[model samples]
Target chain A: MALRFALMIDPLAADQTAPDLATTFTAVDPAAPALTVGELSTQRGDGIFESIGVVGGHPQEVEAHLERLVHSARLCDLPEPNVAQWRAAVAIAASECGEGEGVVKLILSRGVEHGPTPTAWATAATAADFSLARTEGIRVVTLDRGYAIDAPARAPWLLLGAKTLSYAVNMAALREAHRRDADDAVFLSSDGFVLEAPTASLILQRGDTFITPAPNGAILHGTTQLSLFEHLAARGFETAYETIPVDELRRADAAWLVSSVRLAAPIRQLDGADLTVDAEFTASLNDYLLSPRD
Target chain B: MALRFALMIDPLAADQTAPDLATTFTAVDPAAPALTVGELSTQRGDGIFESIGVVGGHPQEVEAHLERLVHSARLCDLPEPNVAQWRAAVAIAASECGEGEGVVKLILSRGVEHGPTPTAWATAATAADFSLARTEGIRVVTLDRGYAIDAPARAPWLLLGAKTLSYAVNMAALREAHRRDADDAVFLSSDGFVLEAPTASLILQRGDTFITPAPNGAILHGTTQLSLFEHLAARGFETAYETIPVDELRRADAAWLVSSVRLAAPIRQLDGADLTVDAEFTASLNDYLLSPRD
Candidate 1:
């Protein structure tokens, strides 16, 4: 599929009348490059971003994504992004990719190294297939995130809770999992606390209760997980947030990795060891996650 | 000064006659943009980079920077960069800057998300002045890097030694330091061992011995520090690599932050506490650091 892109050099100044900023162009090519080599986003990964799932041309959990984007920008000390501009951009991109499931990304960066303006853009592209993993479950490996559970509290400079573009280490952890013949990875703190996954949140079943790690500044609060917990609470399921030990993962009745695009993928095996999985529960949880909502 | 940039889509295939790839472009304007929104470098920070100082249009310590670039790529599992192509590009950029001190950066990224090739570029711009810091010295604050000293050794997936473009945390640390009324920062491990500065190497004077933190996989092996150690050793100054405790920094006679561009800037104070600095000694060290070398 040909990827569609739109660039707003100064997204803050974007108004309804600006065609390139308001309307998604199919083939309306324009002059001037979208980015320069000196952009902080290119040179230093100094930016905040969000990837929203588009199902049948409708964005899923956009308000949560936007809230997280603002929180991330605050962590990086970047200027506040114009949420109306972002909403408009997302609408254009989603409309352009009509009737199909796609990925819409909102990127707000600290512009050029020497320039004061921030660079923002929206992109629409075909989503990758996670159908097999979502149905058949996935195998995972445990990797160390090289931090103690309290690391973030002591060191805010780490930007642990922010969804920034400096994801090289996260990508490396995923590649290491792939090399070890696993489909995904769950990170463990150096002090033996179970952290979140590289790009997802961890959820496990303990008896009839659904438990996930607390948002202790070491992990990005999972938007999908929040939605799932609300749905589960409405259906008479007990939900809790606490620090989980790595060993407890093996003892859980069932485990899953939850995210924006993939929803909830059950864990069939971890570190080459088989784990319990309830397929019926997995399907029901995915149903609740993917169901239409504002 | 207007920054000069040259893009090489596939630098590995660069040859003498490929003007756009081998020879730096002056004004060969293109209709299409150089970077797309889907670039991994912009989106995920999946790239490696090097900044070399050019004096009188000659790139300083090119060999050391290139060696580090290769080492960084290996850590990231990125495709090997073509050194010959990089050399040609750097030469052209430095030449274009013409007879003045400048900064030339070599950036190699994982290309666009949909493309298989890597994107490489060389940018030349006037260097920022460090004359004040070099002469009057700088005050520094110590911040925790939120990692144990042994974290990197046990977790290679952290990409600790690789100088990747995912530098958001580094940039944040600098900003934090600036907010605290300091000019720079020195990061300490969670276990209380001094690691390195946000963008430079930490060198402390313990009597006559020059002590620096060993490359324990948690810090980038600094090129400027290595050159300074060699220069000091030749001049009958003792040097050693060992893990320096944070307390030692407070009691040290002198300290300096060393980097390729900034060279050597003496530390006037640490965490608002004054320290001894011999101006004559600092000037001599700067002279040795900037002296002609291959």
Candidate 2:
């Protein structure tokens, strides 16, 4: 027998709307027949997923996000979800959702298949109350632990580049950060290089040049980060992608964690070090990020 | 409602009859109700699991296997399981199963909440007919992927040693290998050092010594490879845990991959070179590994 339960979406609809959260798609559509929750979990670690904010009811960076999804599928050898099917799912989900700047989480996972078979499944959902924009600056902690820098690279067998659902570790890291009474943990290499945060992109400023890790396999090829890179270049901000050691991070003029949801969050403190970087950096980036691109 | 499934026994029963798999603690009976699957998957990836061969109603490495299950839990920060409960589950599953040396996997993932909030959870189970072990050898394609070699040491904030259910990357790497028409892929660093095999232990033979990557946070601490090291040591063979560069691997006498299921599979060919190392080294290791430790 299939399991059934009421999805409490009513409470979420009654909220101030935020423009960043555009409804691109949703997995739990009202009109479509629902699937058993167990079935959803049993499908192999399905591929990876991303939660991007939509602007003006439009999925931000749709093409680039889809490209990453396709790349992740190829890397994991998962079957590519049909583009039309995905577009329809997103439309259906967006049509029924209520309220504000909600989240658009795109999950490209494995389809229902057992054994050594190629299966790729993609699902999108609009999450309520998952605003990346926060009122207060984040208290960040730095932790040392990793064999190598898990940055993104152009490698054929790179999983860090693909957003697969084996997110137990990622979620656990967040929980670990919470245990320490911090917002998030920064993953540093054994050699003490500032890598990406758990789910967000790393953006730091060295002089007038903004720097992020290169698109290596050690890190996820974030869509927002990529978008920001292009926008920064267009706005005449000096930008470069290079390896940044942990010590250099301490000397950074400013730092912020970027992601689709929390477009760019100011880094107030690093491991309790008082960061006196320009708070205006965040404001400027946010202004540009939220403004509609012609 | 709880999902009900029939339990079978035979090979599991045979292993249980030995009393070796029984918990040594007199205070707490080895056989007791443990934790649920969801808790284990969420918490510390703690659990005792075995992919064994059940030939003619007997399970392979029943004692050593069970002992390893306990060891894995301890190493990964998990609690001791009710061995009796595990044995009972295994026995029931084995009895009703078909004939032949099918795979039997026992997992002690998470356990019952021990009163106050525990730092970790525990669980265990067994399964038959796992496919990871049957392949003669894996054809590994290398990826210049940079993993934090000291990810654990650098990130005390992250649980590097835990074997949580977040195995998407590991599984994804296998799929990548399959896509490349290779059996498996060895994750490489930007510096060209062989970091690990997604699901198995890294083994490189230089002259007479068999060297594996150290048990750093970068890779899973493999139980089978550790057993082989002891076996190799007993025979005056030099087995060391050290960092191996990918360039050095290309010139090594041979290379092999070890895991719970694959045991020890020689790298017959890497890229395109035929190492032909399996005929002797893999067979010798297999012979020693398959032999009774006592």
How does model 1 score by TM-score?
0.94
Complex DockQ per candidate:
0.57, 0.19
Say which docking band candidate 2 falls in: incorrect
Model 1 lDDT tens row, A145-223: 9999999998899999999999999999999999999999999999888899999999999988999998999999898
What DockQ does predicted model 2 obtain?
0.19
Residue-level lDDT tens digits of model 2 in A215-268: 667677878888888988888889988888888888888788888767777777
lDDT of 2 by residue, B98-189 (tens): 54333455544333223212212111123333333323555678865444454456454344454444556566667767777888778875
lDDT, candidates in the order shown: 0.83, 0.55
Which run of 10 residues does model 2 chain B get worst, by summed lDDT? Answer: B1-10
Instruction: Report the TM-score for the A-chain of model 1.
Output: 0.92
